[model samples]
Target: MIEHRRIAHSLVWSTVALGALALTGCATTDKGGSSNLPTPDAYAELRDARGADRGRVDIFRDSSGLRLEVVARGFGPGTYGMHVHAVGQCAAPDFSSAGPHWNPTGAQHGRDNPMGAHHGDLPNLVVESGMIGRATLHMVGSRLTGEGGLLDADGAAFVIHAGPDDMRTDPAGNSGGRVACGVIATPAG
Candidate 1:
């Protein structure tokens, strides 16, 4: 009788542990089913025109939406406009090489625009006296893979402008010139 009681107690604890693990696994799945997205991926590297490491951007997928964490440094002390550009090139002096904002849906520019905001529209980054800024953005209607994704064939870039985004103008909200740019890429295994 004593041996049977001990076995039963051990079985109960083992079952509880297994149940917890199953719940944890289920929490990681996406709405449709299991998620195929990458977690904690260093998807992009930002740099200034002088080829200095200004920051890095990480991409992660969760049940809520796609999350982007932008860690920046060595920037002017003010609010700067940041966006995901269409191209991956970052030509120095002028970052026109980055092309325009990522707008796969043909939407108008600016988050405040009544027409629509571009897919790459993101909140402005505010830098203090230390010249550092960090922002975590939750992106809906976007993904890290598949069609119209950030990691698409042509690739995408992160662009930081000299001024704040007006959030209501077409073609870039008069965000001024691109002060810094970073191309998003997948890391090697």
Candidate 2:
């Protein structure tokens, strides 16, 4: 039963990903100069320090909130910490250019902390054998462009850590070094 459910879920996400890919080339802005709402969709191509393709991240906005899915490959099998960084720049080697975690509300790190669980806090990502990992249906209850929303003037990014998040440590949940990074941006950009 669990296997069946997993298959169904994978199929659903694959379809949605294909849909996003189909609309990737379309204009996301009010290009015609009409009263069209801005499409709050974005994508990111993850890369390792050596500039190799690590995977991709797709973010979709809905009425309730934002949904993000991460598909990763070519990494060691282990649980790793993931978060949305404040800056969009994902410089190679260390990716410190991505800046700190997105915390508009000034909350601390980790969901397990009493005074924490900031906006950028996300569930840990687990990679299994064959260098495959998928973190699907991560709901980020934040807007794309608005007060306290992501994609600010500095933009945002997603980072994959070298170790699992302790889920209680301040600042970074005691997660290890960053292994992969991706700059989040609209497909049209």
C-alpha lDDT of all candidate models, in order:
0.82, 0.84
> Which pairs of residues have clashing backbones in candidate 2?
none
Candidate 1: list runs displaced more than 4 Å: 1-39
Write one digit per residue (lDDT tens) for candidate 1, span 119-159: 89998998887878989988788776688887787788889
In candidate 2, position 75 carries an lDDT of 80
Please provide TM-scores, in order, for all candidate models, with all chains considered together: 0.76, 0.77
lDDT of 1: 0.82
Model 2 deviation from native, Cα RMSD in Å: 12.0
- Candidate 2 minimal-lDDT segment of 10 residues: 27-36
Off by over 4 Å in 2: 1-40
